[model samples]
Target: MKIFRRLLSYLEPYRIFLIVSLGAATISTLVALGPPYLVKLLIDQVLIQKNLPLLNYIILGLIALYLLHSGLTTLRIIYVNKVQQGLIFDLRNEVHHHLQRLSLSYFEKRQSGRITSRVINDVETLQAIVSSGAVIFTIALVTLLGSLIILMRLNLKLTLLAMIPMPAITFLVVMFSKKAHRRYRQMRRRLADINAILQENILGIQVTKSFRREKLREEKFIHKGEGYYQANMSVIRIWSVFFPLIMFASALGTVIVLYYGGREVIAGNLSIGGLVAFVSYLGLFYAPINQLNEVNNIFQHGRAAGERIFEVVDTIPEKEKKKAIIPPSFLKGKVEFDKVSFTYEKGKKQKEVLHQVSFTANPGDLIAFVGASGSGKSTIVSLLPRFYEINSGSIRIDGYNVKDFKLGYLRENIGMVLQEPFLFDGTVIQNILFGRPGASKEEVVKAAKIANAHNFIRQLPEDYETEVGERGVKLSVGEKQRITIARVMLKNPPILILDEATSSVDSEAEILIQEALEYLMKGKTSFVIAHRLSTIRNATRILVVLEGKIVEEGTHQELLEKESVYSHFYQMQFKENGKIIAI
Candidate 1:
């Protein structure tokens, strides 16, 4: 019920539309009561009494009643739909905007398809409830009450007999609705699982095909599909039993009315016209009762979907301090980390990834981090950007603690290029402009030239306007990396972090990327996590990380003289490349 009320609160902005729709539905229900009464009048007055003059008047009243009912029904549908669609639109917008503010860790823990289903599929399930279910249920209650009053006035004893099955019908509806709610909730979860598998398979299709695991993938999909089928079948089974039982209970009421009323007619206690009208009103009473049961089913389904959507909306978003300091427009990127530590969760345990790691980079210094895989090289740089909050110690930029600066202001001054570059599905020019949306055309071309991407871009048929497929599939890895570099160049931040940006490219591509890096690193405090030790030979300083701690640090010659961790690493690389080196 709390979930249901929360869903309805979205309709507060459009209450006026709801009120107008309710009024139309109420009038339509009242208008429907006219035909049964008119039929009684026609039989009692015109047919039996042979009254010719009043025939035309009664016939015209019935026609006019029907026309009014038709007009109000149309108005009701239009306004109801307006409220329904308006509420859905507002809810979806809010949910999507909230998702944008969530932290990266939130995404890491959940599947993309599961999140998407809450925003789209779960919200869509509420449509039936908002559009027609609420208004129709109200109309049914009103019409049922009106019919009960009319039936009692026509023949009280027969009306009592007609209601004998009401308690049984109500019991059946309540029992079925409870079972339906549980089944529908299960179905929604199963559907999300299927969507998760589909999304994972689509994104990893290349890896699957490379390993020739197509048959395995298909079998996995089929297994999930089977679960979805079984979940739906559970609901179907409930409905099959529920509907027949409800119909039988309602039908029993009509049998009671006929058996009792026939005796009253024969004994002259009730007029024949009155008996006919009573039966008509009894049918009207049961119609709304049955319709209310159907509306209950819709409400239960909507309640389940509402629970899923609100689960996301109600999650606490990443904390953004409103009064946080704003950095200067142009920053001198001198970064210092003082005894930082971090832990990554491993099931019920916390595994510390960084242990009191410390480093300092003055403005215009090229500091390179070299380490084996899982040695916390990338983790150290990630902390500078505040991607994850430190478990201890402080990271400061230009003497200001990073936690004191606004997240946007902090990130805006930093530029990053990962090993595997990600490009959206768009034109080449658009992807370049993504770093700085307001950059001029000439500025874009200048940045591309600096990254050595201008020459190849021009050789393409569409030049900068050529469409890059999903994740830039149309471009080679080297081209993608260069475009990414061009994007960072456009950003032109005071601080740059390059994580093995040339590791995957060919030698020729590496040379171009290295040239771009040289240009980009000038006058900036740069952190380079290098896989190839040869590239960082000219770095102003080098830090060797081993087991989440800085084991050695110095300039190239100074580190070689020390014959420490850095010297050992340099020797290993030299041996692998068949180059003789003196340690």
Candidate 2:
């Protein structure tokens, strides 16, 4: 009920449409009542009295009543659908916008597919409830009340007998609603699971095919599909029983009305015409009850979907301090980490990934971090941009704590070129412009030339206008990496972080990229995380990270002379590369 109310509150902005829909529904229901009452007039007053002129009038009136009812019903449906569609649009926009505001950790906790399902599938599931189903439900209640009043006025005794099944029907509805809501919730969850698996497999199809595990993936999909089927079947099985029980309850009312009304008529206590109209009105009353049963199904299904949708909508977004201020437009690029610590929460336990890590990069300093994978090298640089908040101590840029700066302003001054470049599905120019949307064509070309990407881009069919495909799949690995570098170059921020940016390319590409990096790092405080120690040999400062701590820090030659962790790693890499020059 709480979820349902929340769903209704979304309709507040569209209330004018909903009110118009309800108004049309009300008039339609009243017009509908006229026909059955007219049937009574035709039978008792006109047909029996042999008044042909009045019979013609009654017939024409009935036709007019139906036409008006039909027109009003059409108007109601249009407005109802208008309300439903409008609500979906607003809800989806809010949910997607909220998702964008969420921190990276929120995405890390859930699959991309599950999150997508909430935005697309789950939000779509509310369509039926807010459309005709909602209007019908209201009309049913109104019709039930109106029919009851008329029934009592016509024959109090038969109306009471006809309603004997009401309490039992009410009980059935209560029981079905409780069970159906739970079943639908379970069904919705299973459906989301299937979507998750499908999305994962589709994205990893290349991996599956390369491993020759297509059959294995197929079997997994089939297993999830079976779960969805079973869940749907569970709902179907209950529905099959519920619909018949409702019908049987309604049928019992008709039987009660017939047997007792027949006795009343035979006893000359009731008119034949009145009994017929009583039965007709009785059908009208039960029709809406039965209709309510169907509407209940829609409401239950919507409730399940609404819960999932709101679950994402209700999640607390990334926090910014109320007093956060924009940093100066011209940043000095002095980054300092003072005993920063960070713990990652995985289920019940917490793993401290960075332990009192401290470092300082003055303006124009080329700082390098060399460490084993998962040694917190990337996490150290990520903290500079405030991607993840620190558990202790402070990160200050120039003299202001990172938290003191407005998040967007602080990040705008920092740029990153990651190992795996991600490009949106668009042209090369568009991807390059993503770094700084307002950059001009000449500026873009200059950045590309500096990154050594312009030569190959010109050799392509459309130069900068060529489509990159998803994640720049149309381009070579080197091409994509260079484009990302160009993007960062275009950003031309005061601070730059390169995370294994050259590890995946060939030697020729690596040389071009290194040359580009040298130019990009000029006049900026740079942080580089690299497995190849040769790349960082000229760095102004080198830090060796181990087990989430900065174990050793010095120049490349100074670290080698120390003959400690940095020296060990450098020597090992030298052996692998078969190079031992003068140290």
**Quick one: best lDDT, which candidate?**
2
Residue-wise C-alpha lDDT for candidate 2, range 153-193, written one tens digit per residue: 99999999998998889888888898898889988888888
Q: Output the TM-score of candidate 1.
A: 0.94
Model 2: residues with Cα > 4 Å off, grouped in runs: 471-473, 575-583
Residue 221 lDDT in candidate 1: 90
Clashes of each: 0, 0
CA lDDT, every model vs. true structure: 0.86, 0.87
Clashing pairs in 1: none
lDDT of 1 by residue, 1-583 (tens): 8976886788888899999999999999999998988888888888999888788988999999999999999999999989988888988888898888787777888999889888888888876787768897989998999999998888888888888898999899999888999988998898888898999999999999999999999999999889989999998898889888888888898998888888988988987778888889888999988788889888888888888988888887876677798667788999999999887553446788999998899998999987778889898998888888788989999999998888888889999999998888898999999889999999999999998899999987789988885844378888888899999999999999999898888888888988888888888899998765565787899888888998888898998897587678577765487222222
Error of 2 at 253 (Å): 1.1
Top-TM-score structure, candidate number: 2
User: For every model shown, what is its TM-score relative to the native structure?
Assistant: 0.94, 0.96
